[model samples]
Target: MLAPKRSWIQQVVYLIGMYGQFLKVYVKTLVEYRADTLIAVIAGIVAQGSTLIFLTVIFNRIPTLAGWDFYELVFMFGLAATGRALNQTFFNAPFLLTGYIRNGRMDMMMVRPVGVLFQAIGYSQELNGVGQLITGFAIMGYSASHLDMAWTFLSVLYVGIALLCSAFIQFSILLTISVLTFWIQEVRSLIYPITWLYDFTRYPLQIFHPLLRGLLTYIIPYSLASFYPAAYLLRPEQYGWAVWGVPAAAMVIVMMAYFIWSQGLKRYSSVAG
Candidate 1:
């Protein structure tokens, strides 16, 4: 068949750009609720700080994880935490799938000209993500500085790519879970599992056996989201294999998730008003 025109790709880019406008509107609305946003930021700081303290406790007790020393582990934690936090900050719309479907808000969004997937993500920014982002950056910076290893320009580049890949991978998984709403009337039950899976993405899979680790890398792909990339960055000699797989898998998953979501759109039956 003749290839479709370049129009489709352009439309997708246009859709993303439009979301930038919506982001501005979202920021305005958020600013209107200054107290709530402020409280959320402060609370997020405390919660995130507690998490770091817990990690410190664990690492202090354990000598090394999968032969990765403290600095290396910290690097892994930093990269994945930063990536996950950024994902939460930006593409948080998928989390609201339950309420949207239950209220038939899905029907209303489908009538719009823009991509409904993008539409579902409200134009407003997630202020709370900012706190997490700050925390993640702090940890990453601290870890990088304390390490005996020197990072060349290429290493820095790799870190940035790894971070982006991990975030995209996690978002793809979340997208896949949110689409499950169309299959089941209510899938709020799925949210806990989703969060649990995401939280589990922070560490090296080597903690588990080969078979179970394979399940994570293949079945749920938490490895692509965090574990593998973190390993590659932390212990390059040991996890050189995942340097490619981590980023490559994330890209592939994002594409596949997009395809799956498009399929779900076809199954959408607008609730008759």
Candidate 2:
């Protein structure tokens, strides 16, 4: 006899349960190397904190960058950092797909009952991402309190939606780049340059050359993750359209990443073979 099919809600709950089990295993492993975990957390905090410090110095020297004040820039930086932190914490394992493919581990992953992406994420947890999350929210809270924008319930809702969508956008971009490993065979070198694109979202897009701005907005769409959302939040009258674009961009990028991953999966070859 055939088994009953699961409802969509049941499937989601089952997936969540699987992820929870993965998290428990990872935490057990993390506890075995407490010192290393502490060091990683500290390093993550310092790295993200230093960026805020550098921006503070820059703002002190110049009143504004393309008409955005220090607090406004901090808001943008915080949003970008928060999105990146979530990506690193949950989806960072995909970035190491090159190593997995080259080492024949992806073959093992493919044999698992669960989805390959979920298995990869479960195997590749970055505990230090907690530090980035802490720093990102601290800066975001401080900046939001200082900003002159009127605080309304809807405004809060908008920020919450924007942040969630931005995190998805960042994750999708990383996954799409990681998928290139299947064809390239070794793509570890591309990781840093791709991550460096986040720096563009830490400031007002207006400061960049028009062509570069177009690239960041269209080809890469990194600006949609932070800059556009920030613009919509701080000056809605001028950039309110971003309120719609942020979610749209997230959807488009995620679909694109999934398509790339599926295509790449067809090209995957086991290293052992």
Least accurate 10 contiguous residues by lDDT in model 1: 1-10
Report the error of model 1 at residue 224, Å. Answer: 1.3
lDDT of 2 by residue, 1-273 (tens): 232478889878988998899889878867898887788778877987898899989978999889988999898888888877877777787677887877788888887666778778777777877778778888889899998889899988988888788777877887888888877766667867877888888888888899989988888888888888888888899997887878987898989888888898888877787
Where's the lowest-lDDT run of ten residues in candidate 2?
1-10
The TM-scores, one per candidate, come to: 0.86, 0.90
- Which runs of model 2 end up more than 4 angstroms from their true locations? 1-5, 27-33
* Model 1 local distance difference test score: 0.75
Q: Which candidate is the best by lDDT?
A: 2
Compared with the true structure, model 2 gives a TM-score of: 0.90
Clashes of each: 1, 0
lDDT of 1 at 112: 71
